[model samples]
Target: MAYNDNDGDFPGETSTAREELRAEAREVLCRLVGREDADFHPGQFEAIEALVADRRRALVVQRTGWGKSAVYFVASLLLRARGAGPTLIVSPLLALMRDQVSAAARAGVRAEAINSANATEWDQIRERLAADTVDVLLVSPERLNNPQFRDVQLPDLIRRTGMLVVDEAHCISDWGHDFRPDYRRIRDLIAQLPGAGDRRVPVLATTATANERVVQDVAEQLGVAGADGSGEVFVLRGPLARSSLRLGVLRMPSPASRLAWLLTHLGSLPGSGIVYALTVSAAEDTARALRDAGHEVVSYTGRTDPEQRAELEQALKDNRVKALVATSALGMGFDKPDLGFVVHLGAPSSPVAYYQQVGRAGRATDHADVLLLPGTEDREIWRYFATTSMPDEHRARAVLGELEAAGKPLSVPALETRVDLKRTPLELLLKVLAVDGAVERTQGGWQRTAQPWTYDGERYGRVAQARLAEEKLMLDYENTSGCRMEFLSHVLDDPEAAPCGRCDNCAGPWFPTGIDETAKGSASKALGRVGVPIEPRRSWPSGMDRLGVPLKGRIPEESQVAEGRAVARLTDLGWGGRLRTLFTITEGGVQDAPVEQDLLQGAVQVLASWEWAERPIAVVSVPSRSRPQLVGSFAEGIARIGRLPYLGSLELVDGGPRGESGGNSAFRLASVWRMFSVPEELASQLASARESGQHGPVLLIDDRTDSRWTLTEAGRVLRGAGASGVLPFVLALNG
Candidate 1:
């Protein structure tokens, strides 16, 4: 059989030829892999064809068990035969690397891994690579970070590296489901490689759970732009549905009852499966209890020995271990297609985490169950895990202090010492804080996460508190929600038309039916307030305005607006207008009113009335190309303020050039800060600034740049705090 590329221009010939080629390719792959017939879904085959003919770098987001690895394997063989150079596969897990290498060897292709597995024979592997005897090299991100690897002359030996593949590329994004700081540096390494200059080496990124942002981040990080544009990026819709897997929520009245339910379920569930415990000790103790109950059980956690982990993985694969109770560590890279069940003994901190853990079941084919056993103490445990040790105020102050002292990159250890916390807690706190732009980690040490704060402590604290509260509330929602599957799906932003009928809530008679979506909307509306209005007609006529606040009836430009006059006019109107508008209102009888009040009362009220108040705002604060440092500083300020109550819901918006350049920009201190500043603070004089649903109160930190802050209803409320113009307020700083 023969195949025609998808890029063909003639429809009839393209269709006929492509069919023939696909048949030929399938036969070749089946023969190569020793399979009777290559079994794959339609979606999987289409993805393979797209990748084969793709001109630009591409990403394959096939769901687990969709034969993504097979696509690459076939592509690798074809590319090598066509003299495209050896393929370089970068994977995060050693086990996965080993599996691919073994499969390749079976297909009569030369494959080798340069990891700890071959530590004793590293020189031999290097020799094989240098001699061009290896067809593919499976490596880890850590290996690429090695200084010796950076200095190596292997680029000359492997001058024609065909394809660069990054598996689980979402790790490049700090906000990804799984974040690894080291992954952020992979862009640099890719940039320095040959063939990755003007035209980047063809890159293939693969992941199962990457969201839109993550997909973009992966493409940028791997120097592959426009790869996902052709529907080549497959996203399997709908929740994982398996009827054989019993969905159960065991609500234990007490710890004793919870333990009893766990034991009963573990004993009764047939086939091997995972039992996820909330803590390390819980996992171990539960495993011990199961062992005592005459079941072959093993426990795994962060502290588990490497050898033990290997043993457990092998045992599970071989069906020797009946059950494995573990923390979240085991779910990441484990691919057991026939997992019978996944029992969560307690609530995970976030719905994303829960979905990931539950997804491990029925990966290859649907016939598994996910059991959520929420004990009375599970809520408390989840809270403990979600809550940051440092208050937002303390974190903001500490971050600023560190930045002032170091003036350079500082590692986590150094920051811990300065912040006066134990290493583990401090590290976790820093990671959380970093998400909100409170602090940033560098080669040296952690620095202030956001731009240097021009605002006082109270303002900074408000922003921080808002952010922390939102994170905690999200966690709380997960713990308390009645529909576990729905909650998980919501967090993932999956738009399934209907709920999974197989979930615990859906299957049970007690499923929550009375909960109306409108009820939530009503509650939000009831709590929201409308702000005073700034008559637009009165505020805009001013020839010049500082902030466009109406003076008399006209707004003035900053050049003409006096600070004192602007403040007086805003106070008298019980609202704040732009400085420019306020100047006009004071100088001329243009019937000027407060711009802040008009914006708050009008924009916020409209948003709230339209029920778009809760929609997440995309905050873009990166300055134009001319002002890079200001972009960074502004981003930092945004991130710092993103942690506040009314501000934390905003999404960081990035609009940088595509590919590795964009990915690298995401990690830059300034870029991160800008990304974190989606929900900025608004000036107080806007009457409706405090109105619920108005998307306002956003602040851009770069004073020199033309920064625009759009406010949401929540943001308006925060902005209303600056009713008196004398309250020197930055747009988002405590608002």
Candidate 2:
């Protein structure tokens, strides 16, 4: 049967021809899949039609099992018929790519995936691209980033490329649930692809969740103009209510009891499910215990090989494995629609991560359950990692001593030679130290975590305060006083407009009485009409600025002038406290003499490099605005520059030389520096480096206009000096 042309935009003969081709394609797909009608969601057909009709870019954000693949598949089929060249779909996971290839084969669409495991995959993919045999090509970001793939010689294929679809699009956002540096580069690669007659290929970016900032960032990075165009965007909300999924949280008094409870529950629960542990050892031990208890269980962690992962997935799919104990590695894109349950043996670091993992169950319409097991051990583990995992003074000093004694910067391998820990732990230590300003990593070697281990209690205090603030944000999400689902949706920017009634708090009564009942009782009592005082609805302030503690005024002018020379004097006098405590300079006559600004700045750099300060200020710019706004603007800029790894713990201040800001203020200039291993330290530095006359390569965030601002040569000099534990001050107007 010929399908009618839903719209008349396709012109006389072309319209008739395209309609005939679509019908043929549909028939072919149906026959290939051996189905009378494709089992697709209602919206799937509409999305496909929109994609084919519109010549511009588009994004489709739909729920997990809502046939997102079909939308792209149908579009590819239509594009091929229209003589468009191969379509490329960049996937975040290898398994997802394989699944799409399998689905396309079933639908009679010629598609293939280039992944790492297969030896001949790259060559075959390249051949297909060159021969124009592949209608659609699926690839993981890692595969696309491979130098071999980038240098592949093919005709101006991008110009003929019909569609570039990026799945799991949230990875483009730094604030997303899954943040990957490699994913951020996809935008540049897409932009480099040759477009139809100099016109960019119609790009389509899709994901389950894309917040406002994320959406903007993704569009900008991909150079897609905006969310609206011929390449428009459509967000399809999935049914949040999974009534068949039973949700329960168990609180155990001890870790041993929690383990025991896990064993007991696994034995009692019927059908296949997942037990999510926080660590590799936990997953292994839990699986072992479950097996000992006579339960059919498998385990998976980051260490699991691809072959094993495939086997485990197959076993789960075929119902051969009754239960699988896993870590976070098993959550993303492992689509087992018939998952019976998801049990968290320990508390997840964040609710967003927890929800995503639990949501994996019941994708195929079967009733599923989710269990959260929080025990003392779990809490202890969380607290320990939250507080102590990162680098500190002693650790930094040890690393520095080792490096100095060796008389050279240490490579990853050489550093491993000195450290007793495994590679992962060592990397984590290095990362934390880098963030703490204790170390600097070169292209091929590592420096000390910080300059030296000098205690500055005041500096540590500020760092501690910052850490506390961060902890509070996490705590607010975990608090049971409010609806968990509502809190999470609001925080994570989920587009669902209404409260999800499926979560534990929403499903169960929050209080003895309903909200209306409580309100009525309170209203009556307030009116003195014989009732109870209205139960106050608790509220927490939203936005980071509202909750952040304000910083004190910039360090004194004399202290700034004395800088490191004065600091060295004090250190020599044995006035060392916690690193955070040395914010002010003491006036002990000779000890208080202001040293050259350069010397003082150099000392400050030394302290910062030594990890004695929260951040190393290569340049400080004083702009006339609130610190919060400045921090936010800088973060946006960093994301734009594709420098997402250099953001953490930012502070903004309302300081600069009045309406007439200083011309040479380090705060007023733009400077570039490589953010080695320090993610958190970079965030703090960007935040704290906001003050008039502050020496270093910093920019004054002018509230008047939004444009690219540049830093002076002096500012660049300071950035260089700071590279060697010195601060340079420069200033420039907001030209």
Candidate 3:
């Protein structure tokens, strides 16, 4: 359905040249697929023609399995045959790089990759590039900014590169769901290619998940069309609809019920594929439950060790596991052509992102099932991730000011001391600032750039609004009466969108919607299981002295708190919802209420299961300005149940905790250091309790433990007051 633009005059548009390139491309294509009769798909030859013959930058917006990789692989061979230098590909994932390198071998083209995982091969790859033996070289987008790679090898590659390909090209655009600041470096890479017309380094950018906005944004950003209209880019776009996909949604009442549906019906679907979750804890917890049910499954998340991730991915590829319960981190660049189905335990925030994930299935098969079991907590988790990632102006300014004042490079840890942002968000903020020209990542760490930057509040606000709108659209997709495929097509601006007559809306539920009581009970029990141990901190945070706190290295053993217990995580499947409700109801301002009956019972169960060396004889609560009554009553209830003395809360003095939540560890420690002291009566009792060491350990309790600094400081105060030992307990762990 693509109309030939023929709007620009460039090299190799001649009929003779086109005919010859087409014939040669078909030969390479046949080799790629191991089929002597194989030929280009509708847009593959045209895309290759655009890149090789015309020597033009091109954007191919096609569905997955539409031969996007084939076009580039074939084009790279053709360009190499023409005496062009190596094709340098900017891929976004190591899995993609691995797959690309292997695929290139089918066509007998040499390909190599240098990533964080293969640091030892950097030398060999550099030698191959110098020897002009590598036909295609793949690397992550983040690698473009590496101090050594940028200064040492990038310049030579840029000067002699034949063609450049950006896999998962949507990462470069802000409008895309999986946007990354490192991807913006592709613009700079393209700029440095150095040539015009026939001598130009023809570029190819490919993706399956780009919408119209993402398409246009990427096209503009990749220099497909310059702002001054000096260059032209050939764009080949096709429909996003997939006939192989049979989309459906199965709604469940609660998280337990949704998980129960999976436990009962997963094997009934089809072959091995993914079960996506919205958070890491949910992914890990769900995997454990599935495995406990005797399913051959494993969890893949951001927390999964890098080497193990590759093995897990291979396991799914070989169909050794039933499925990998994973987060969105498992997405992008993973290729499994004949995957049977993809299930979501909860809905992703955007339908566009959902399409990208579900598209993973049925790639090489005639049919694959895609189902969603929507949960009530889906939107809340979506909003948490959406808002937390946005860069703050105050934090941005603080980072920039420190870099400017230092007059030299500053590492991330050093910056943590001067700025309050956590490692993840702070790194993200630095990337955003780097893209905006306010700072640059250099040898030691980061340095302020000479370029000026102004905070764009309006732009950030608009993006946040877009995310909210997308969240609403995701809800609509969950309950829609229209064709689900067509709805997704329109969401992604697919021109050929039409009712497939295959979804639940069109055909009245093609999937099984029943779960037996046994399955539900198993799932409920798995979710109901609670109690995560809290590991006590052994050392004080660095740079604490700068915050007017005298602490360094390891904490004194006499003052260190013992290992504690948390009832559950805020994102846990079992006790998470009740705990979330507990905290959310009291989030806006200070409020006082006793612990609810159900949660109190859950806490008791945690205590019963806890293996203690000695039973505590006293309970002391941390003073909570926001939840005094809750913490106080919870402590008092524990004392009443255990027959222990109910000592008062440690005193809050010297203007209590200096900063808000989400600060770095250094600031968090500084905020709580010396902020608590043993009250007179509590100290008197603690003194007598430890005089003969007959009172045993004191149970320290709080509503939540964030940063764990408050508990550390409070325990230190109690130990100084003569308690033999301190034991900490909390309702939730705010990871």
| Best-performing candidate as measured by lDDT | 3
Q: After superposition, how far is residue 647 of candidate 3 from its true place, in Å?
A: 1.6
- TM-score attained by model 1: 0.56
Error of 3 at 537 (Å): 1.5
Minimal lDDT window, size 10, model 1: 559-568
Q: Residue 170 CA error for candidate 3 (Å)?
A: 1.0
Query: Candidate 2: how many backbone clashes?
Result: 48
Looking at candidate 3, the ten consecutive residues that score lowest on lDDT are 1-10
What residue runs in model 1 are displaced by over 4 Å at the alpha carbon? Answer: 1-17, 31-34, 116-118, 153-159, 189-200, 220-246, 386-490, 509-735
Across 544-632, the per-residue lDDT of candidate 3 in tens digits comes to: 77667788899999999999999998888668877877777444665568988777888898889988888887999998887888999
For model 2 the local lDDT of residue 541 reads 16
Compared with the true structure, what per-residue lDDT tens digits does model 1 show for residues 1-735? 111122223223357657765775676578555887665544444444544544335566544565567766776766666566677887887667766787788776788887766688778878887777878888876665443553463354235676667777766765465666556656655554454332334556676666556666666666522333422232323233233444555554543344555555555565678988777756765676667656798998888876678778879878898878888878656777788878877766555566667777776545676776665555445443544333355654665687667777676544543554444656655554554455655545566644543334464455446445435544554444365555544554444424556656666732221223433343223222222221111122121122122223432221121111011122111121132232332343433222243333332343333322233232223233433443344334434334422222233356532221111111221222223222334332233444444453233222121111211111222223332111011221100
